[model samples]
Target: MASGAIAAGLPAHELAYRELKQRILYGEFKPGRPVTLQGIADELGVGLTPIRESVRRLIAERALEFHGNRRISLPQMTHARLEEIYTVRSKLEPELACRAAAHITKADIDHLEAIDGELDRAIAFGDVGAYLKHNFRFHRALYAPANSQVLLPIVESLWLQFGPSLRVVCGRYGTSGLSDQHKEIIKALRAANIGAVREAILRDIAQGCTFITDELFANENQP
Candidate 1:
């Protein structure tokens, strides 16, 4: 194949892997849903080899489960996994938020404010996808000042797991008025009050934890 075709086409396996991973992470493939290599290959118009490679990677990442005969399912969230992810976030995200508050520039703050406005619109329109996307960008912008490249991947992994649950929670409880926390965070950042910024972020994350925990417990009692 010519270099351009090679570049454009990409290896089928890599394409399959990326497409499958994105779907899973984005909650398009819900928890416990069966995902077969052949099914994925057919869906993506690829061959089995690439789909197999994709499945292997997801399994390694604990994002997918594989049974004896190549049967696979999206990984289900456990209380233990949630606790572990939350613990990591509790330690890292607040510190990052504090660092961001100290180092963020006016431009960064302005960008975040714009995103906050977008989030408010999403909430008003009940656009869950838009809300989630901009909400993620708002948090990412806050953490941008930290410059911790190594830590970002770990944080992003936690997000991949938590994102679906968050969607569910947002669906259950309408997201209107959620931009209040963003405003508080911006206020803390503007004042360069690292403590206030950290507290605000912690409170934001804690509220999410409370919701998820409540849902988990409620589900458990549904026998």
Candidate 2:
């Protein structure tokens, strides 16, 4: 069992799952890097049983890929797969943001702004980990106010799929080269313009798509 305040009451397997998922989300484990059950058990200070179960669940979630030989790794992004993800997000996410615009309170906007500030600082320092973490936080904070059970999980699943790839892009491009339309999102939200908010979300998605697509192209052209 892992000895930590957050894992105190949680079951060993659940704790392992949460920790593993977070590691993947934060790009601590790069895409296609093999992770062994024993290695994870040692790292988390838990037995292999719990770590194995946790890894199995992540595999089922498509967040981690099982490469036979008892090896597990984060999934690599492909051009086709990323295109599908962006297409879905380009539609669903903007709708979510539009809905959120109607119900957003000043406090919610304040929290989002704070998250953006953190995200900006992370970019300035070229901190890929902090940038990815805070970028997710900002979007989640924005969408949570919509209070939709169905859409939130769907959007999160998409994030789980592409997040590792985003980290790869950040590593390749450097934070200074990254682009974000989140400020446009904030401006639209503040103005209470639902159409503009939706457009901003679409633009954000488009920018991300362009970044990932460019990375994919560069990788393909490499000898």
Candidate 3:
């Protein structure tokens, strides 16, 4: 009974963490934006204790940084850090996708297809926020069947770092081509072709690399 109660409480804690993390990652709380424990508690309608705990976890993850006394903000992205993250993701995500392809069901494909539709709608309406939301969901859905809870959180942390910069890229280059990758991924999954799925996932990540690489060079050449 005690274990059951503890298990039940986990989701609420995770809920607090995820909500706070998403806001930080998605640029709802921009870099250098101040985050107060009480403000988050009030915004989330939770107690100060849970909000404090969530903030501490994020700080540990390097998603939130503290400076001087009592000031916290989202971590700023740098070119070297972005390169390192994409390198790690380039190695892991494709393998996870291939593993997931082996176990994917029709329902999983259906859900992914629906998410693709949402991406399309977000693109059509020029809603960057919605596009990012659906894009994250679509990628998560692709790897859901892998049951890799261990690596998934690591992947999410990478996303936390990558997500805001992705917003910058989308704002500059537009996101119309992103949805097209989903079609290829889904086709590979439907055929249960692990190699093809892996290649498609790698291709997707590589495209982001190309964009970020160009952005990095552009920033260097500025001024």
- Which is the leading candidate under TM-score? 2
lDDT of 1 by residue, 1-223 (tens): 2243268787766766667755655556667767666776677776677678878877776777886566788667777888887898988899888776777899999999999999889999998778777878888888999888877667766777777776766777767634347888988888888888888888888777777777755677577
lDDT top scorer:
2
> What TM-score quantifies how close candidate 2 is to the native fold?
0.91
Report the C-alpha displacement of residue 17, candidate 1, in angstroms. 5.4
lDDT of each: 0.76, 0.86, 0.79
TM-score of each: 0.80, 0.91, 0.86
Residue range 55-130, candidate 3, lDDT tens digits: 7898887788876455677777777888899899988898789778888999999999999999899998888788
- Model 2 has an lDDT value of 0.86
- Kindly provide the TM-score of model 3 when superposed on the true structure, using C-alpha atoms: 0.86
TM-score-wise, the better of 2 and 3 is 2
